[model samples]
Target: MSNKQPESPDSAEIFERITYLSGKAQQMLLDFWTRQEAPAALTGDPFGMTSLWPAMTNAALSDPLRLAQMQFDYMQQAAGLWQGFLSGDVPEGAEGGAVRDKRFGSEAWASAPAFQFIKQAYLLTSRYIMESVGALEGLSPREQEKARFFTQQFVDALSPSNYALTNPDVLKATIDSGGENLLRGTEHLLDDLQRGRMKMTDESAFEVGVNVAATPGKVIFENRLFQLIQYAPATETAYEVPVLIFPPWINKFYILDLTPEKSFIRWCTQQGLTVYVVSWKNADETLADVELDHYVREGFLTAIDKAIENTAAPAVHVIGYCVAGTSLAAVLALMEERGDGAKVRSATFFTAQVDFEDAGDLKLFVEDSENASFYGELSEGRGYLDGRYMATTFNMLRANDLIWNYVVNNYLLGKDYFPFDLLFWNSDATNVPAKWHAAYLRDLYRDNLLAEPGGISIDGTAIDLSTVKTPTYIQAGKEDHIAPLRSVWKLTRHFAGPIRFTLAGSGHIAGVVNPPAVEKYQHWTLEGTLPETLAEFQDAATEHKGSWWPDWLNWITPLSGEQKPAPQPGEGKLDALEDAPGRYVKERIA
Candidate 1:
């Protein structure tokens, strides 16, 4: 009876409900229309999907028969694979088998035909997509680059090894460990999340000045921006002209003096050469306004003056690594303008690029609009680019080796992190001042300014690489993704003095840190002037089996003056404050 009475009295309530429903429906229709009318920019097709789809559609329509034939061929191959699996007969081209990638070498994946089929399908699809993207037309170079990058991201994300459920090895481990591995993996993930970055290496395993950067030296000069270290000489007499190394401020300077056996500084001191390294401060909010000029006048030049005073050397042989090399070129140009070029005897650049035209995949992130916005936001409150941001970007450049490998081991398989020294150094990144980082990206990367005359200025004096007349020695790595060999080769066009360019084996760090005793990788050397093109130079060079360190010593020995009694630590106005691997290198940012 109550229900009937309520129903009878609900006319006004029904009208109100109808009105509300109609309003919602009308708003939904309006929203649909608005979405349909939205601009492409607001639609957020960040992967260049709009361009990719049209190109793909056009290609497929233009050659339907070819597409069908390719699909049919794939099916046939897949069927044959299944047949071989049932017969226990390995397929042709199966010497290394379907699991050619060493990353998937586990018996769980390698011995199983189903997993092998999955791997093969993945590889074929990835190859096809890459080939298609490479052949894409009607898109700008930037768009093409974006397309390729995103395609790679998709391919990498789809790898079976990324998913615990998909990866047989991970599944087996999970079963064997009775789910403890999963718990450990979850713990690792949570720990990394709390830390705001991945742990690429076992950081706690190595301590600065203890097991890792244990090379013998003394911090002779300390400034707000840098601490200059004068290594204790291992030889009775040292070269009259000292060698001052300006390592890239992006990382700790001890990379040059990591372990005694692998330390470049140790090698130099043992060779009867006075070694001085500038350990740059890892900038924080306080040093946010630090500019390129500060790095020049305050950091490098000050170190140069101190080195001269300490060793009583007339001039110093300057060596710069990575971005330090770029700064060195600018410093020399400024010195030339100031009539102080005489202070620098010669210049050597390690894996450094004066011309940023082909700075490799690193340029991609700087070029991306989305990444640019993120960078802008990243520097807003921080006033400096976090070391983790730079570290993540660098790791992405070699995603397979640097990123996914660690992901699988640390997260999926729940294996402890490797205690590799190089990985440790890589993860131990340093922050860069927002102002300086912005300028570097704008001038060198975006504008390609450093390569051109009057493209940039320091202390109101325009920096021209052509004006830097110091005899130069440039070393580039053959497999260096960070600083491509061709990009470094462009340095030859800017310098007026005689150039000695060497192409070493391995990558950015390993190539330079190669010790002769290891006898691991080879290097290439060419006599006379470097050819205009990288290809020509590579063609003309002769390959030598062994480290480039010895060759470099021989090359720079002449430039170093006559041997004299070794100089004492902090002999000049500067006094030794602490041992090698000083406070600056140990400083960390939260």
Candidate 2:
């Protein structure tokens, strides 16, 4: 204790102090500059006599009448807008493009001319700034990306939805609640601050296995990396080729089996296909050294072995969603190297991209500098990336819907959180092992390695997608921001076998989980040879009503082989560990 040095300020405190001092210094500098310029500005030579006159003379000579007319038009528009506000005759606000966008749709916002004007002004200003930034010259690609990102962040932060006084709904709620709403909101904010992150949904509204992930099944196999659940068959005899699902480890597996009505697992079982899903364990400190090889070996390969043994099927049909599809493709490459490629009869990828060349907006976060900073910050304690960090990044991609919507509801209005199953699933996230995450970013995202031959090795064999010849069915969401349709469509170039690509309506999660019973959303399908480009495919595709699930079932059923008696859970050496939606899924990192 005597030898110990005195405590110093933490990084956060240091940054706060630096920010305060810098802001104060900036204000002082502005005041000094204003004082210096005051006399010149009053004398009407603020920009300097020579420069101001020359610039005006050049402008007048160039196009004086057009410039004058443009200025007059802008002034007239401004005056009209102001007059409309005073007369309460402002036009309706622009419609928000996002599905969850109700910011400009409310009667309150439309009725208030001031709010209407402000909203329109904000929209116009943000659009102009964004367009200007996009058209900026003489900047490197990376600098341009950074500029766009920060500009968007500033625009989002300044949104009327984020402020109480400027937001009509929030103001109305404040008045109606007699100031109690703000008190409740304060409590909510304090609670979130203490918890260290915002709660996106009412976590208490649904319980795992009780209401959600309630499909009847049993954990038939377990390994260090994942647990395989074999669902109880809805039909007596199932397809001879068992269907195994590899869901993305970034999320809990129950996203496929949220509830009976919408559950893809239940639908599969009902359609006479024995379904087995891999429920990955949420990573922690003890599992920090887990690498990509371990996942391919112990997680996917092992699960496939167990499923084949239990069902006594020579080959199985595989479905991989999101990152799992990427992993499956890698696994297939490994399998091809091992001469064991025949074990899988057919493959289906749900919104997964093997090629990362056009990975969409997510590429912005995968740059060298940003990736390095993320690695350093996340590797500090447990050597694992916190689930909340991933959740926050994804949420920021859609700030208006995922972040600010809840902020207003939970804090400004003091309303109870809506019990949405999808949002609940979205909120329940899982951590990623540091080693695996780093490798994934560097190899797949950064280097674009997976698509190249010998770019990556798993279990001592180099992974190459070209060698994978399994008949493939690829599904992509047209509106998916995470895995863009073009990125998903790139898989056709690498695969040597017959491929069927279906483009679905909606986004990543909703597109894949869509059940036919809902009878919502449309999907596009095209027969004959795949097109050379995404645009051509879209142009030639035929639109079909209803979910893509039914279309998928129709496509796979033909290849599934003749029906056989459904295999019982734990028929092989692996005994049934527990009921469906087992203990592993319930284990949260925090």
Candidate 3:
């Protein structure tokens, strides 16, 4: 520690520094807007709900009594807060102002009369707006979801936590630092603007193939859609039947291979198995014609073909995650139709949805024709769904964590984010092909056809889930927002084979990526007959303490055939294209 005291910046100096930051931020934004590849015109509505105003308005007015009751309730709550302030006592119960969100948990928010009033007033109004709009009658389920999602977004933006004056912690930070905090915050703002994405972690602290995604492997094959990486085995010998994994294309595959301690790829390699993973291409106009069929054939099927070739194995164990899991189901169905189902030994799905019913908040973005049209125009020129849109929508799903929390920490409190591997992977986004984007949202999410027999066709072959009798294992997150647990459980009903389904203890990312070394989460399994509904599954589930990776390995080892000498890369028909954490995974969205 230095003996010299640090200089405290004065108000005037802080103001000048802030002014410089503002100018820098403006220039950075201008530079970004003037990029050669910037969108030429306003492509599509970001909110995509400007056209729904009339219908929403009519629905609100249709229940005048309900609207009036909402107003009465809000005013009544406001009056209670005012009375408590006048009496110099903070109310602290259900009848009082409710600070339901964790943002206002500080003592200042509850102890100060003025702060208490401001907090309660904001809460009351937010509740009124959300409940009134969300509960409006006569709108279809899709319309209702759109209204709820967009309205919550509007409400979240107005949070007092985002403002320095309204936020108690920000005010304290400004005071203790003599306004230097705001100046630093301004600089952070300018930096984020230049980078074109919000700063969520210490980006410089980690890099692909160095610290994260450091698992040793070799890219044995490449195609226009994806590159297949065959990991170097950690064990002396491996399973006779190799395993292949297909991660979602919406984001990079590195999430599963984040670190030596956390990488599922590394763990699998150590458990005496030959593993091959598909690293999807970051699509652009050059791949315009690439659609769902290409992804199913060139991406999933091609990876399987390569894996089988590398090991000269009769069949391979297949795993798919998120959107990839959805595509994998179709690929299996297609394989069955083609008499090629024998190529797969078994299948595993990680939070993948085969059934789209009650798919949750994401339905808001795709359930309407106008929203689909908006996305079409957004992707028409580019020939792919922009990564920014996907990242933004996912961020909105948990705005409090992914959006506002960072705004308060990085822009209000002026603190640098701690190094986090997952958030870094999240910042690295990927684009979806235009044709695939349209078909996914329309045929599955909107039409709900994939779950219905003969209701959907893939590459001219109608996919029947019942015919997909490949022995299956499925794992889902208990609190998953993207692919609800219930929807994942619905897969057990469709597949005509023995299935083992398990539920982990966290949300989507945390649940699926947990490593046994950390022992951070637990998973549940059923003792007997597989059930049709999530409720039944839960009732019969036996809770297992710790990561589910070990259980998965135990179940799969039996199906893996006997262990044998590990097969080295380039020992088969295809030679190593490159080292592991291959080139395609390194491509970032422009």
Q: What lDDT tens digits, residue by residue, belong to model 2 across residues 362-412? A: 776675544655564665657677777788778877777778878888877
TM-score of each: 0.87, 0.85, 0.92
lDDT scores in order:
0.80, 0.79, 0.84
lDDT of candidate 3 over 202-321, digit per residue (tens): 988889889988898888899888888888889999999998998998989889999788899999998998988888899888788887878887778878887887788999999999
The predicted structure with the larger TM-score, 1 or 3, is 3
Error of 3 at 252 (Å): 0.8
- Candidate 3 least-lDDT 10 residues: 90-99
Alpha-carbon deviation at 449 in model 3, angstroms? 1.6
* RMSD vs true structure, all candidates: 12.2, 12.9, 3.1
Give the per-residue lDDT of model 1 (tens digit) for 1-590.
35554233245654465456446545655654564443232345433466666765675566667667766866776676667777866375432334467567777665777776666656666666676666665566766676777678778878887887778888777655655566567667767755657887888888888977787778998888999888888989988999999999999887887777888888888899988999999888888779888888899999999999887889999999999999999899889988999999999999999899888787776644434445555665667877777887787888878888878888888888778787778778798887788778777887889898998899899978898889889999999999998899899889888899999999998999988989999999999877888899888999999898887889888988898898867665678889987889998754
Q: What TM value does model 3 have?
A: 0.92
The lDDT-based order of candidates, best leading, equals 3, 1, 2
